[model samples]
Target: MNKQIALHPDLDDDLLDVMEPDNGGSVSDELSRNLRALWSTFYRNRLLIAAIVGVFMLIGLGVTMLMTPKYRATTSIQIDQQSTNVLGNTDQNSVDPAAAWQDADRFLQTQVDVLQSRAMAITVMQDLNLNANDDFIHQMGGKPADRPAGPLSLADTKREQILNVLSDGLRVDLPRNSRVADISFTSPDPRLAARVANAFAADFMIFNMKRKFGSSTYARNFLESQLSDTRSKLEQSERALLDYARSAQLLDVSGGIASSTDGSTTGTPRSLTTSNLVQINDAYAQAQAARVQAQQHWEQAAATPPMQLQEVLTNPAVMQLAQLKAQAQAAYQQDLQRHKPDYPQMQQAAAHIAELDRQLNSLATSIRGSIKEQYATALKQEQALSGQVNGLKSSTQNEQSRSVEYNILKRAVDTNRTMYDSLLQRYAEVSAQAGVAANNISQVDVADTPDKPVSPKPLINLALAMILGMMAAAGFVLLRDKFDDSVRTPEDVNSKLGLTFLNSTPMLDQEMTPDEALSDPRSALSEAYSALRTSIELSHKGGAPRTLAVTSTRQSEGKSTSAFAIARNFAKIGRSVVLIDGDLRKPSLHRLANVPNGRGFSNLLARMGSIDEAIQPTETPNLSLISAGPLPPNPAELLSGARLPELINELAERFDVVVIDAPPVLGLADTVLIGSTTEATLFVVEANGSHHGHAKTAVRRLTGNGITIIGALLTKYDARKIGYGYGYGYNYTYSYSYGQPDAPSSSRKWPWSKK
Candidate 1:
């Protein structure tokens, strides 16, 4: 009987809602809600959360105790502008407010750096002999032997620590738009802190004055040297100019003008002398003629001889003839000396000589033809020389006229130098006065003996420690919440698997027997079960659902307990209920019901036994129990067989309600097999025991297989532990109000007592 029982139509919407409805609240309201939620979560996991907080607090307190107590002292200094002299009058050279403000900012920042600087720290340390005395270090748990051999280097890490201390203890702030700066310091010892602060101010003032005076002195010296150099150069330039003017006779150039005026009429008119001009012209003409001759000579020397004619004349044939002629001439001379006129050899030489003479004559004619070309070139050179000499004669007359203009310009340059020397003398006197004015910066205030020492730690640090502690605790809580995977709110159940949250049964610290839960309905625990019943009824949407299957994802998650509690709750309300132990493999309802465990559901199924024979009544009226008779070889096959649905239908007809306690959904198919017979299924999750994913997985498995998940029931609740109103006291009140013999009268008419 694989009945497809829809849990409800519209399964996607939130059906079992437990979250408070929004009231259109402000941001404060949301914050309040969030705070409440956090409180609830912490309350639920109070022990674990307390353990975490206790551990951290212990660490913090231990550290605080172990740490050496550091003393801090502070001193304040009021900076007065009147203490120092203003360089110039505000009226004469007023400081720009913007620029002065910028200077003030820079000055304050520089002062801060100076106070924290190694140079300043070293000075204080050395003055106090802090390096030799290790009291401060030892108080901080550092040993004298542990100290570094050299001075501590202000590296990034050390500087950060120093800066942190400075930032914590020392303060130098200027009042808004005011010239005064207030300086303060805090140290472990009050007097020392005050003294150190005052010392810092004193040292800074001294440093400032020294720096200014030193700079001024350097500047004054440099300027004096420049002024002296300028004066000397000016004097030298003026003297040189004056001497040049005097030597050049430029002192009375006006007298020269008068002479020129007198000479203009009295002196004979100085025209160019005619003889001198003619002589100059003649020289120029002679020089031009020489230049032309030289040019022509050079051109003639550079000309090449005719190549073809020269080669022909120097030919081998012509040379041979010449040689013959020479031989004939020699033979004639020899013949004259010895056998001149009558030798046959001489007659033959004479005949050859005649032939050689004829050839030499022809060669001489060719040479004559080449010499004729040179004669024409020589004639042109001679004619060009005559014209150049004439042009030189005209150029000499022009040079004689420009000599008078050159004399007048030379005299004017000398006069300007004499005037320059007079101005140089006056400039030197003014420069010396300016150089004297440059030396300024004298000390206005000196340091007084400091009254105290400063530093170790301060009160501000204690306050900061507390603040940091709180923040660390809060951060841990937030991070833990973010990573936790357990089911926290009912909204988680609804949202994860689209299952209705039948009830959010508040947590319980200790276990309660079934008899105790039923006898006192007004108890907190009983009220929670009552709420579970009401929620289940509402979830039905119409007729009350019979044949409810109780299951969970894993074993020992209180599924059986929740089934028993819910059945007892129903039976207490006078409804006829049949509690069946549907989990054939491991049944525990027989123990809870105090009924015999033999011949239960599995036995009934195997033998075709009547439901009446198998069912047994519990001590509570209207409550009947059927335990798992025996362990089945195969629970799934037995539950899924035809006999199971027949048994479920038969029980439903006889009893107003049938509560089937099914096995875990994930590990076995028995729950899913039995689910087809049940009208609705209820998932039971143990508070803080079952993971959110496990519960969701169970719901998903049931719903995914088309089983009707009615809703969920949270079991083993610790209402007192979770800050809910429940416990043994509430149970005692319920028992007494419900007419038990030993009941207290006060519990009977309590305001929270149910009808």
Candidate 2:
């Protein structure tokens, strides 16, 4: 038998005050609620979670122990941006720091790629003779080449296999803002790893040098070919120039100047013919001036009388003869005055005057003759100069026409000469440096034998395993919570179904009966209902509802039990409470009350009996029960009438609280009809039993019909299932058995559960 406590007639104001925060629905409160829910989920499944993490950790340890350790050896090499110039030619203006840095970065990246190339790997293999070295092959996890029927085919297959292994083991890395590249190789043996790394570095340098040599050799050959062609062209052009100059008779004088007839030099000319023409032209101009002066003198001498001629007048001999004639005339005039006609002295003087006059005439005529001779000579000289000038003009025109072809051939010769010189210089440079290879790559650090393996670290693997296991556990829990939309707690009642959460009623122990637990006011079930009563009282300003109907989404969800408990708790508060079984299809209040079903709610609504006849007294004081009198053929049609409302009004007048146990909401309209007659309806949800969709749909149906829902009562709540009361502030396991503190509790136990 369960222990019973003294019933209190007053409601618990403190419990009602404790529920005020839930109504506030603040953001912080919601966040805390959610966080607590998550923690509770983890707490409930802590053992399973620990087992999963431990299993993963064990797996990690096993794998770490079973795996083969790999040793890595790294060799560092420096890559220069600009290689050394062996030709001693450097362009200062071509250097740009930014451009050079960019080029260096690209070059380093290319070198890294080259280090990882298959060809480089082949060269390293050949240098190390790795395919032929059995120990190295075995260390790299390869088999020795087998001598098959075809040796060539077998050798090729072996080479391919080795290359694959080498490629897999090789790694080259060059970081940004750095010129050094690290070439690393991983192997089971540290010595083999180091040897292969060093071999790669050495062979890479040799390969770079070989490439440089090949480039220089190719350059030399190309220059040589070009030089030969240019030399031939230069020779051909020179020959053509010489042949044209000779055939056209075009001569080039030493200074392009010639001497004139007057002992003066002329201006420089284009060729020998031009020089001759220039000298003759100057002579012709001088001759023209001389001819003009001589002709003027001759015209004066011919137009004037012989004695009036300036040359004749200015001549010394003519002047002397004139003086003598004047003297003789004076003497003859003196003598004529002395002697009469034929005096001997006068005759001698006259004869002297005549002879003197005749001499003057001879001198004048001689002067005239000399003027004509000078004019004739000047005219002849001018004509001769004009003829020479005309002949030279024709020669110059002919020479100019020949000079065009000469100039063409001269340009070809000059061009070919320039190209030949350039090709010769280039060929010489390439030949000189063909054997000198300037390698930009140099070894920075040779790889050494590794002291320890780089893989299969126990601590890191275990840590990673633990982290992955935790993530997987979280994902699983979230997935379960997402798909499991069951009403398991008061929180679910409020959150999932969007109903007011009144209180949570703990499930009764399997050994105890619902009647026995309800009879004891000290039991968890009793305290829960009392809380439910207080929550309901706080819900409305007027106090607890006068007429309340209890219903659930489905049957066996403890609706009838909750109705009985609510009524009994209300009666303890000194209120006259009536419990009515409103399920016309199936009545359970009669069974719970242990009363005979003679007449009840259905009979009262059917007008077959009075309210006094249908109403029956329960064992608990201040409490009444009304059983479903008889199963109606059509419960929905029977409850939809006006008689059900009249019966509820009669019960309300007699009892302070009317608790009706109605049928389920789904697949039936009887609950909605019965609930409409009451002031409010209590939605009873089975924890971990009722589906959220069904409960929501049932509540929607009730509300759609204008039936007021007071709140939800979470029945059959298992505290362990949802982490101990879900922070509802009510301990579901606590019992008020004042004398028995150490009584054995009834709860499930697992292997890892605490005491």
Top candidate when judged by TM-score against the true structure: 2
In terms of TM-score, how similar is model 1 to the real structure? 0.49
lDDT of 2 by residue, 1-755 (tens): 01222232112222343445546656986787678778767766677778888988998899999988999999998887656545443653232233455466666777788888999989988888877846666887667777643646876877877888899999988887788889899998999899999999999987887775534367877887888888888888878877777788877673322346695543322577887888989999999999999999898778889999888888999988898888878777777877965877777777788888888998899889999999999999999999999999998998887777777766676678778988898776676576343677899999999999998788999999999888888777777777777887556776788887777776665677788878776666777777677678878659888899999999999999999988988998799998888888888888888999988777877889887887798898999888999887887888888898887897788789988899999999888888888889989889888764888889899999999998888777666656744234224433333344565545422211223
TM-score of each: 0.49, 0.52
- C-alpha lDDT of residue 370 in model 2: 94
* Local accuracy of candidate 1 as per-residue lDDT tens digits, 672-726: 8888789998987765566647666777778889998887765554434444333
Q: lDDT values of the candidates?
A: 0.59, 0.78
Q: Count clashing residue pairs per candidate.
A: 20, 0
Estimate the overall C-alpha local distance difference test score of candidate 2. 0.78
